[model samples]
Target chain A: MENNRGNKYSIRQRILSSKLTFTILSIIMGLLVGAIVLLIAGFNPVQAYRIMIDGVFSRTKYISYAIIYATPLIITGLSVTFAFRTGLFNIGAEGQYIIGALVATLIGYFLELPLVIHVIVVFLFAAIAAGLWGGIAGFLKAKFGVHEVIATIMLNWIALYLNNYLVMRPFLRRPESESSYDILDSASITILEKWKYSETGREWLSAHPYIKDFLSAPANLGFIIAILLAILVWYILNRTTLGYELRAVGFNKDAAEYGGIKVEKSIITSMMIAGALAGSAGALQVMGVTKNVIMLPVMEGYGFDGIAVALIGGTTAIGNIFSGLLFGALQYGGPKIQPPLGAPSEVVDIMIGTIVLFIAIPKLFKIIMNARKRGEKNAK
Target chain B: MLNDIGFIIGTSLMYAAPLLFTALGGVISENSGVVNIGLEGMMTIGAFIGAAVGYYVGNPWIAFIAAGLAGGIFALLHAIASVTFHADQVVSGIAINFLGPGVALFISRLLFNGSTMTKSLSFSAKMPRPLNGLFRSNSFSDIIFNQYATVYLAFILVFVMWYTLYKTKLGLRIRAVGEHPASADTLGVSVTKIRYFGVILSGILAGFGGAAMSIAVVSNFRPTLISGQGFIALAAVIFGKWKPQGAMWACLLFGAAQGLTVYLGGAGVINISSQLLAMLPYVLTLVVLVGFVGKSVAPAASGEAYEKGE
Candidate 1:
């Protein structure tokens, strides 16, 4: 028996074995596939990609726009990542998100308080509502052995319809508009908006003579909050006892149960936490971006897209922030690509799908490595 | 009242047909020990292909086959990822779901000149109802008998799947492999092959379900056409307790819920908005899933990768 412990491998060898190698390779392959699709569709791939990149970073304001789009995505990524680590496939994040948004919109309109307290109240109620929404599925899984995937999906539809109903009612409804009425000024959170110094939109530009270049992008307090939450989630998962127990239950429920960990309780808690993160995402979206509710033809696919973000990030806390940003850039740039390139913006969707497909098959790297080893053995 | 009930039953059967095909596919795949959440993706693909083909060829039957074949091809990707690469089934399924809509939408833009929808086919091109002439005078008979051909076919597939699963040799092998792969392998069954068959069949069924939506029900392909029907079908599989006949009953019940919503809302019998009414089926699915209707057990190795000589 040869002991391989403490054996130093070359940097190249280590890099080849590292999990990030596969992720990077998958990303490259995904981009290449997307480029190929673009080329096939009669567009110059280089030009299209260049345009996308340039558009996402075109101005000081554009960068903020990207971050604004990223806010919900990062939160949703954390939501999905947390559930994944806890061994639950929470396909119901979409439902949780909408419920959170609904609660936030309701509270934002009804609650009359100072700005900070109102925002806090809206978020708190949103999280509680969405947490309970997600908890129902968890409870079902724990008690009745119901599959969470099925339960969550069903809940998503229910949430969508419920939101539609809520948005149409008198209290929330805006006269002569499909969307709900705007939240009170106290409930809104906008950093750049305040900097612009106008009562509304670009009006502040004239009043704030020195702020001509002030980038009044949709970027707001939500993006900052999302980034902080990601770091906090990483710390909790890596350092906390609750996370350790949750991970143990995720790894093997029977074994964890046998080890005296309350597996069922962990499941409920993990789902609730995941739900809270997603709920906050929706709440933030309403408070930071829309400030009002609109009737949606479909549940915004943010929750489903969160799955891609979590998967591409390898389900790490820090990785989620980067991946969320990457996706946000793509989304911000997507509309720009179509007008100039004749490419459907949906190509981004295809690229994301292909990337996830490649990542899902990590054994592909193993097979390649084994083949190379076999070749070396033959040469020897 | 009787006419309204007939309308509800008719709509319910139409709605249930798609769920039936998808749920049967789910049962077949899960029975063979592969969990497929990609049914939604597969159905999306099938619906798009079915609609595009039907629009071009003007033949509903040809469109249906093309859809099923397209579905089978897509499912093969899942098989390669989950079976050959030993990836997580859920991950592979999710990837497929993503790909399905992306690919469909991309191709639609290419073929249909940037529209997210396919060219609509004439109502005459839809699946024929053979009993329409005979049942012209009777609402009950018309509703039950004079429906899309796929509606009849879906009910028929329930018996077909039930017999195949419980009575056929292939079904036994699939069940054995799904339940205890190592033991099945010892008995000389190729677990991989059986699982592949099961997943592929699921794709085909789900694909046909997609075709049922576009060709029989809607007659056009929209990105939102498949929506969450695939997930509802999944719930049907669980509610039915992984049994084909049980799945049919569950699908019908869910479909009936959808149909009732339509009837009540359309007839102004219910003062609630249609959006709120739409919540009935999904809420029912949640309630049914939560309530212990019976002992619903999934196949033992449904989501695990089987490794030889592990």
Candidate 2:
């Protein structure tokens, strides 16, 4: 019995110390904090949370919307995660994203080509533009010893204004609207978009109410692309020699240099790839949902959200998909609580913040474990 | 023509004041070896608190102080996570950034009857213009001198900070702790305490910067009000090479660029688009960083968690 009890205690300690365990605990703690905040603000926490959950899962359409939101987040999260794995903090994902969207919008509006080729060209140009945007920071960091953080932050602002300037131009701006003109039909990536609107297809969808509802959303191939990209990133990081070199550089730059890895080229390449990922997110967003670029007074925070997703996901490719979905669900459902429960949508922000905060201090778990061990020792 | 120049200078001072306060905060916190990217969040919280309190209490001074206190409270979280728990400073800072704005907006909506923006303060409730009646309206002197009280406070604090950093023993200890906490520990200085002080102080000053914008520059707190000023101040801290006076100059330069944008937009003397003009400060900072400021080294022990006996 004594041996069994000791074994149980050790097992509990081991489980408690695991990263997955910590992540789950942190998420729970975050929800608890959100509940407390809701309670203090004179709202029913249980009811609010129920509404939020219902908002995401109540309808097939809602689930599609959630997925739609998750698509960009997953791509951007992968962008940040890739840069992080290479030991570079790519805060300029926001800038790269903006550049991608801008380039994609320009291409999608101007270019008239065959269907498959049109979409491919749009993605290619957008990715290249954003990759070059990110590469500028890498170049600055490599050659001039400028910090990536500052360079990226500045670049984010420049990108924001550049987007605004381009969108406002007479050639791009939609008449009587704050956004750019919609992309050509060929450039759109929405799944079954034309078919769903067609008479025969509408009749078919009407017979299947769930499919009809799902089709009502701007659901596109972005999610599939995101999944494929995540798997590709995973394979690259785990398999390729380039990935090995980048990981080595990330682990220790001095050691990587001593080991004869070209650190400068690696940094530049990592940033470019990261930029391309973020750029792809923007391109997909334009092609799938908005279909046009809207001038924003402030950052829309897809990139910042990516940072949170990457952090929560443990900077893993697969982990980002899950965390991105979680974030997307929260973002989609957060507004629902505001309308019905009279709770603020910012509650979602608080929950996300709390989760990130708890994750940051892993020592809290260690402290608890140490105390528990001491308690056991004292009881014995 | 003189009026336009005066107006531009006034606008520059108005813009510079908020950044100056925040940059000073950055200098102090960074001097103590903490990288505070969350200054933006602290400023956001401060902006909201200042506006909300000013609207309700009808007293700008009280609102400003409240904003600072709110910021300090938030900074305590950063200090706890980074200084005590040995958490990643950047990660902790990012969390604080999210929390600060998140809590601010959540409470702002709760208080303002579901609106993200706070109610605007009356002119009397806003930050008082100190030299308002001293000079003729629209005169160059009036435009330059008849500025918000926070503007003067920001300038004064710069000198005060410069003196403290260069002259005082406390400043020396803060610097010593940042430069080499292990050595500071050997000398019986509490590294943890000093860092906490530095971070919290930074938060308070950042809060003041936010309040300066909300209560003085404009009239109310909106979602976009403190958008990138915190970040610009951060750039100023870097551009200034981590010196208090240097940061002041950097803020002034950025502020002047802002003034130029505002002046050119309002005056329409130049047909430049406002959006393109708005990119001036950020672009200039990047150029300055690349061309002039080669490698601005941070404090020796900055961003590293100090472990005892390690």
Candidate 3:
């Protein structure tokens, strides 16, 4: 009996110290907090959650929408994770994203090229534009010792207003519309879009309604590209010499400098790569989803949401994919609760906020574990 | 021309008040070794609560105080996570940002019958202008002096903050704690207590900043109303090199830029796009940071979690 109790305590100790256990505990705590808030607001928490889950999973169409939502989030999360690994915070991802979309939209609308080549051209230009946009902050930090947070924050506002200005220009704006003109057919990345909507294809798909329903949404190559990029990012971080230098700089700039790593070069390179990743996300979003840049009165928050995704994912590439999907599902399905349970959709935000808050305090888990150990000792 | 200059000064002061309050908060918290980047979030909650209370209670003073209390409550959460639990200050601050708007919108929807915005307050319910009738309408003095009471309070607070931070024994202790908490701890000062006081006080001032916006500048609470103002204030804190008086000047410069944008766009004095005009302040901030202020160092112990007896 003594041996068994000792084994149980050790197991509990190991579980409490593990990262995965911490994440799970944070999530559960978030949900519990959400439920308490719901109860106070006079809503049934269980019913609200049920509605949310059903909304996301009840139909193939809804699942596609969730994946669609997750695509940009996953890519941007990877962007943030990459910067974080290099000891930099790329808060300028939003600006880079805007620049990417702006460049892609301009190229897609103006250029006349063949199918694959046009898409490649658009993406390349977009990446370059956004890479430069992000590189500006990196350059400022490396050269002048200005903090990246302030630089990036300032850059974000510039990008926002610049996007609006460009979109409102006579050449860019669609006739009688608030948004820019849509991309050419060759620039689109929607999966089998032509065939999916053609008369004969629709007739054939009628027999397979599930596939048809899934494609009915703007299901595109973005998610697949995002997954592939995640794998690529993971490989780069784990397997490459460049990744080594960047991680070294991240760990300790002084140590890395002593070890002959050019810290300034690493900072700039890391930011550029991170920017390209975020830029690609914006390009893909334009090619596959919106197809044009629309003027925004406020930020769309894709980049801000990326920060949450990166933090929740433990800053791992693989971890980001799962967290991105979770966030996507919550965001996509949050409104379902509003329609039926009469609970505000903002409850999802509260839940995510609470999760992040809990995750910020890993010491809380340690305190809990210590208390448990003391309680067991007392009982003996 | 005189009226235009008066309008410019008046508008600049109006815009500067909110940033001044929040930047002062940032100055205090950071001076005490706690980096309160969550000032934006605190301001957001304060804005919502201020507007909601002003509309419902029909008293601007009560609404302003309520807003500060709401901000203080959120700041306490930040203090707990970053101080007591030894969490990363930046991460905790980010969480506060998320929680602030989340709670604000949730409660707003609940209270306002599913609307995300609080009802607009009446002019009588809005912040009072103590100097309104002291000068003729549209005169230079009227434009410069006849402002909301919050504006006056914000300026006075700056002086008070500067005096407290520089002249008092408590101020010396707070500065010592920020510069080197270990040394201060050795000297018998309580690092934790000072940090808690700094963080919570910062939150209260940030709350007042939010109320300044909601009750004095704007009359209603909406999602976008307080957007980016907190961040701009943050930049002011950095621009001012973490000094209260310095931050005040930085905020005034940014505010003047804003005033210029509004004036140029509304008056059509320049044919530039409004979007382009709106970008001026942000661009100017970057230029000034790069060209004039090459390096602005933070407090020595800022953002570091202190372990007692370590």
Q: How good is the docking of model 1, by CAPRI class?
A: medium
* Candidate 3 lDDT (Cα, 0 to 1): 0.90
- What's the lDDT for residue B65 in model 2? 98
lDDT by residue (B87-133, candidate 1, tens digit) is: 88888888888888888898998899889999999776677776778
* lDDT ranking, high to low: 2, 3, 1
Per-residue lDDT of B1-310 in model 3, one digit per residue for the tens? Answer: 8888888899999989988999999999999999888898899999999999999999999999999999999999999999899898888887888888889999999999898999999988899999988998888999999999999999999999999999998999999999999999999999999999999999999999999999999899998888878878888898888999989999998789778777876788668888887888888888888886547578889999999878
Candidate whose DockQ is highest: 3
Residue lDDT tens for model 2, A266-351? 89998899999999999999999999999988998888889888999989999999999999999998889998877999989889
Every candidate's lDDT:
0.87, 0.91, 0.90
Model 2 Cα shift for residue A83 (angstroms): 1.4
lDDT of 1: 0.87
- Considering the two chains of model 3, state its CAPRI-style docking category: medium
Q: Every model's DockQ, to 2 decimals?
A: 0.66, 0.75, 0.77
Q: Which prediction has the highest lDDT against the true structure?
A: 2
Candidate 1 lDDT score at position A199: 62
In candidate 1, clashing pairs total 1
All candidates' TM-scores? 0.95, 0.97, 0.97
